[model samples]
Target: MVGVLERLERLRAAADLVAGRIPDALAGKVDDVLARSNRRLAVGPQTVVALAGATGSGKSSLFNALTGTRLAEQGPRRPTTATTLAASFTATNADLLDFLGVPRRHEVAPPEPDMTDLVLLDLPDHDSTATAHREEVDRLVRVVDQFVWVLDPQKYADAALHQRYLRPLAEHREVITVVLNQADRLTAVELSQCLAHIRRLLDDDGLTGVPLLATSAVTGEGVADLRRHLSRLAAGKRAASARLAADVTVLAAELDRHVGPARGSGADRRVVDDLTRRLAGAAGVPVVVDAVRDSVRHRGTLATGWPVVSWLAKLRPDPLQRLGLGRRPELESPGLRHSSLPARSAAAHSQLSSALRAVTAELGEDLPGPWRDAVAAGVREAEPTLGDRLDRAIVETELPAERSPAWWTLVRVIQWLLIAVVVVGLGWLTLNAVLGYFGLGVLPMFPLGPEDGLRVPVPTLLVAGGVVAGLLVSGLSRLVISAAAGAAARRARKRLEYAVAEVAEERVLAPARAEVARHDAARAALDRLR
Candidate 1:
């Protein structure tokens, strides 16, 4: 058998797990059970059995007769027991009585050795016209371990008794006993008939297994049997545990209704991937990748292009720099930084919202309505920060830089040598022309075969060959840079996507998964209560 402390611990653990997720009303009920259980545990080894019944049921009279004291006043008034009155055979149950709020206490002689641990309470009428009287009954009923429902023959089958009290506590059948009090008013046959009808009514109320007995405070009929039953319960020392276990069982069933069937193992990787992709789009990851590629190509062209037009490349803005993306390693700051990436279009925003909804729906598919709502709320709570987090991620990421190719250096040197050749040739031709103009001797010049046997000018050939060679080198370098930049762009895109996926995991998926995990844990705990 599970001990009271173990059972109470389980109830407390389960309640803590679902503290904020469950409905307030249900949470309040669970809290009440915990509070009552704590008080019972503090009382220690005392059996709190309450005398509960409808108005004019002779419950107070039976209470007085059971304890052999007139602790509770029995009278002609409809609601005679206005407050709770307690009679304990044990003297050290003051804390328990205080916790129950029963101000009136009566000391009673121990009737039997087995009944020494009993603490009896005379509670107000269950169907009292005065709200305070009914409230007292409601409050004491929850705190008591066993209920000796002292019903009169007239009001034994009252709907208020069965429907309001007995039916709801059907799980506590083991701890409940129904008494046909005032039995002296009936003859032998009438009393039998009334007992039979009461049994049938209890059966309908789902209290069929609960014990039933006939007692009379006036005639003292069946009172000893009631006492013997209470003695057995008091001696067993199981009433507290039984009552708590029953309370846990009922609460577990109620909580179980809010949980759905278990989902098998493994995380939903596909949903996470899809959400990452959509968020990457919304976060302008592709734009950053494209910027990296363009910046790489531009830098390459400036390094290896024809020196004549390289100045024009320098005049244009660097693609990565325009987006605040590719700064020198030493210049970057260690703080959250935003990219100059443009705002997402209306369609992109819509796509992102749809993706979020889709993920929430898939994750919450089998969850109860409240849990599903919680999941959605969690996603919504994380959404506003997503864009900023992604931006920070993009800034933090080490993107591919516009690294210059090794051949650019060699090509640049060759181009400068060619330009030197052109300049030397031009100077030679100019000197020769100056000399010819003054009728001085002309300098020797390299000859080249030309059409119609006319020698081509050496100076002209040198300048033309140099310019063409430089142009050819620039064109070849452009092709190689373009290809390398395309590969770098692909790599950059993967890196940015990976960073965005991390943000999605932390900001969105983590909370949702935590909720699912809580649900699973709560379900498992409730199963243990069964």
Candidate 2:
């Protein structure tokens, strides 16, 4: 039980939402309907019915007969009734007449008791040669509450009238009545055939069940019945609201074409994931992951490598530092600084474009052409900023920290101790060789291999064992560092993938989804109006 006002509001909301996104002509038509409906409703409850017809159709005659006055002039010229004229059966119709812009107004003399609160307007011919006359007819036709189309036997089926007015206004069947005005010219058989033919034509125009009357203004044929119908319409005081409702209904139907049934939820997870993968590639996720891995390896080598060669590792650049990554500058400051990652290649851009199209197509699968194009256009409009957003995402992403493990410190101490033993063994052997060469006694030899077996020097054992243990410890530390590097790379990939997903959501998918939501909202409102 929605009221006419509620339906009108729904139509207004839908039109506003879909205005620019739809075609210009349709948007303009919706605006016109809203304007005319609001104005007609604002003017009181007086029923303003117009006698509308083509040139020489006896519309003025029908008007005079219906109002019981000669307020309109009838003529045999090619085109008559150059301006709109109105006859008010009640005294309180000035507001409606002013709203209709019909200045030449007349009060019915000896008004019929039955035609109370009726304002019968005899509008200029819709087919007038003068542009002003036709414009006036067009303007009044849109705002009038009801229409009594005064047609003659000859031009009743005229294409100019049916195509231009009747077919288009089929939605207003409840507020429209067709009159065969000049029916005296036809015999009874011809009139019946003419009425049947006109009925068929009305039915073709989707105006079936509309009141059709054969009235001769000159012979007063069926004029009383037309008057009674007008009296009933005027007494009900619902014509204005009904006309507005019909207008809203027609407009809502037209706007509904731009939308369709909602498909799946606006987001397609598969398409989104694919887009994220493409975007991650474009954002240099792999490069950053590799950098993380290399950075970890470089730091570990510097911390645990033999001291003699560890300084050489420092000469090579830190991979994370070279990329200006490894730190979240965005968090420390206001804006993100760009990373030194390589620019996206042309192939990457092409892949990104295809991914964006896929996203739009998936979301807009159920939309009409105009709305689908609208969704695409909205997404494309954000493309220029997408690169910057992605760069920001990469810069803001946190990589694995380059903290040294505790085992590296122990490894370093063990290597130094081994080197010290080697140094002491070399010094002792140098002292013994010098003493033997100078004819002084050598220091006492402490080591013999098994008591009765071949003996080995203590200095020789000390140097060889120290060197082998140091090599083994260094080799084991490297294997641990390699495993840690792989772990760091995996962690970096996870972080970068999350950041790229955010960029995809904010830059591409969000806008496309919003367009889909807009289409759904407009469709829902139009359905409620229906």
Clashes of each: 0, 0
What Cα-based lDDT does every candidate model obtain? 0.85, 0.85
Give the lDDT of residue 334 in candidate 1: 38
Screening candidate 1 with a backbone cut-off below 3 angstroms (N, C-alpha, C), the clashing residue pairs are none
Clashing pairs in 2: none
lDDT of 2 by residue, 412-517 (tens): 8999998888888888899999999999999987876888998878887778878888878877888999999999899989988999998788778777878878
Runs of candidate 1 with Cα error greater than 4 angstroms are: 76-79, 184-190, 263-270, 328-331, 334-336, 435-465
Backbone clash total for model 1 is: 0
Candidate 1 per-residue C-alpha lDDT over 344-368 given as tens digits, one digit per residue, 9 for 90 to 100: 8999889889889987987778888
